[model samples]
Target: MTIGIEYLRVVRERFAVLKGQGDKTFAQLDEEHFHWTMNDESNSIAILIQHISGNMVSRWTDFLTADGEKPDRNRDGEFKMKRMSKAELLDCWEHGWRVFLNALESLNEHDLVKTVHIRGQAHSVIDAIERQMAHYAAHIGQIMFIGKQIKGEEWANLSIPKGGSDAYLQRMLKEK
Candidate 1:
């Protein structure tokens, strides 16, 4: 694969890591937790998921050939609360990932440097992907943090537990 594609792959892998963390975090959370906005200013997980889905659909639909920000996208409304079941939330997540991966799969080496407009700002295809990767990762962190806070003691650590890095490193070294 080309360097640009490889980087996109890395971004996707990081997304997988976040998705796994989200799954664990939301496992015990119900529809109540998914839709619960902490306060008037705070956003719920459901809203975030919807925002991401909209983003993926707009940005990745025509992807290389069109603007990343589609005319039909309602960016402001993405923050609005939407009622959803756990199954529905998962479906939204899956749909976004499918669209994102499909766009990634269709990319060619030459498309990396191609310019795409996001909200009318120009960015190279690779840069655009990188920018959104960071954007999504930030939200994933928020989702995981919120999940941990809500689940408290019941929440299992997604990564190694406190002070377990030595053992984890040792195991990785042994495998290598």
Candidate 2:
């Protein structure tokens, strides 16, 4: 498989893990918790989701053909708390990922050489994908870290549980 395709797969899988981790983090929290900001400078989980969803919809729709910044995107509104329900939040998250995955599936090695514009700046398709991957991972890490802090001892580990990594590694090696 081409590196581009592999990167796509990896992003998709990472997205799934991040989504699940975020959801698990929120499962115990109330709507107030979702909207809580540490200060004026901090964005809540709701804001993050909205921003991510907006980016995904704009960047992925007609991905290779159109500029990554869609004319319809409201960049500022994303920071506002729009959806109050967890269901709505999850829906927005899924909507973005579905669009992103569809666009990734449409890509081919030759398409990597094609240039696309984001905020009027030109970038090759592969470069754009890599950039978004890093961006998403960074945000997701923040989300997970905050989730853990908010939940404290009650927070469920998203990956291997504390003290379970050795056993998990042993099991994986045994399977191999």
Candidate 3:
């Protein structure tokens, strides 16, 4: 594979990491906890998921031919409180990832340098992907944090169990 393809492949794997974290987080909560916020001004886990999915759809749909910000996207409305069941929330999340990850898979080295616009500002395809990746990761972090706060002692470790990093590293080294 060419260098660009290798980078794109790594990008694809990063999205998978997000999916895994999100799935595990979702599994730890019920619909009742999805909408809890620390304050009136703060966003809840549901809002974060909605915003991330909204961003993914806006940036990925028809990504190459048009501006990354779709005219129909209600970016601000993503933060509004909605009575979303866990199923509805998951549907939105999966839809966005499906579009975004599919776009990543379809890219070639030649596409990496091609210009794309986000809200009219131009970015190379690579830059655009990097931007979205960071945005998504930030939201996922919020989701996990909130999950931890709400679930408290019941929250499952998304990575190494609090003190298991040494064991994890040793196991990895042994496997390698």
- Using lDDT as the measure, which candidate wins? 3
- Candidate 1: TM-score? 0.90
Query: Could you give the C-alpha RMSD of every candidate to the true structure, in order shown?
Result: 1.8, 2.2, 0.9
The most accurate candidate by TM-score is 3
Report the Cα lDDT for residue 118, model 3.
95
Better of 2 and 3 by lDDT: 3
| Segments of candidate 1 deviating more than 4 angstroms | none
Cα lDDT tens digits, model 2, 37-98, are 77889988888888887898999899877889999899999987675687788788889878
Clashing pairs in 2: none
Name the weakest run of 10 consecutive residues (lDDT summed) in model 1: 1-10
Model 3 alpha-carbon drift over 4 Å, by segment: none
Per-model C-alpha lDDT, please?
0.82, 0.80, 0.91
**TM-score to true structure, per model:** 0.90, 0.86, 0.97
lDDT string for model 1 (108-163, tens) is 77888889887788899878888887888888788887877787898788888889
| Candidate structures ordered by lDDT, highest first | 3, 1, 2
lDDT string for model 3 (1-176, tens) is 89998998898999899888988999999998899999999999889888988988899998999998899999999999999999999998899889888888889889999999999999999999899888888889889999999999998899989889999999999999
